[model samples]
Target: MKHALIFRVVLGLILSSCLSSCGMAFRSEWKKAPVTSGVEGKWQGTWLSDENGHHGELRCVVAAPISRKLAVQKFFYHATWKTILSGSYEAMHTVQKQKDGTYTFKGEHKMPDWAGGLYHYEGTIKGDEFKANYKCAMDHGTYVMKRVR
Candidate 1:
């Protein structure tokens, strides 16, 4: 049992280190991303849980779709809660451009079961405003952000 705990601790540290590194790289990319009509840029805002009233600061760096056929854009997000607990993760959303110069997207990201298992996101971007609703097995929330210019 003791050995298992030690192994888990070490694994957690390694994962945290990897995530931190990825966050830094995403931030660098965000700095160079150009502001466009599409949702490819840096965003800053807050996430609020409708289930518990918990809220926190949220930031995202959106990358352009790798393939036009797939329409999947990568979003790297760093979120903070309770003023201290923070982590970063990546999600891939299938974005569809609308006729009215807006975009809609939905995606799911799998996390460890203890964390939430799988998080589902549905959102839209309109004129520099990003709004999303997220739901997981443990919680549900809304994210509101504006393009960082």
Candidate 2:
């Protein structure tokens, strides 16, 4: 009976220790922090295409209004290599601060034109810069933005 009791206690201690350590790691990995307000302004930059040699001038406006959502970004991009097709885009993302002080978010951008599919975005905000990977229909690229206003 004593051996069984001892074995049970040992097992309980092992499980408790393991669980406590796991909880600590989880808390550290998902530490909730404040959003950086510096990104709320205008940004101007360029985007380079990975498939073709196409490149373009980009203009973006960011706003962090007081609401349930964290931020909204509006972009006007014009890219030309053989032809010119420029479009204005916008997206809103829920912001979360990462462990490394950078912020990460995921959201969707809807095109204003007819029958245009929604483009999804996932990006990181660090200091005065924001970078995101965007995809819609058959188009995908990285948008690198710097605060200009």
Best by lDDT: 1
- Candidate 1 has an lDDT of 0.83
The lDDT values for all models are 0.83, 0.55
Supply candidate 2's per-residue lDDT for 51: 40
Please write out the lDDT profile of model 1 over residues 1-149, one tens digit for every residue. Answer: 54564355346535764665766776677678777657998899999989768789999989889788999999888877667556678999999999998999999999776555799999999988999999998678999999988
Question: What's the CA RMSD of model 1 in angstroms?
Answer: 4.9
Can you write out model 2's per-residue Cα lDDT over 1-149, one digit (the tens) per residue?
54564354345435544554533432332243123365455656777655433467665555554464544433333222222333343466666778888978788866522222687788887887878877766456787877663
Residue runs of model 1 more than 4 Å from their true location after superposition: 1-20
lDDT of 2 at 119: 73
State which candidate has the highest TM-score.
Answer: 1
Worst 10 residues of 2 by lDDT: 74-83
Judge candidate 2 against the unseen true structure and give its global Cα lDDT, from 0 to 1: 0.55
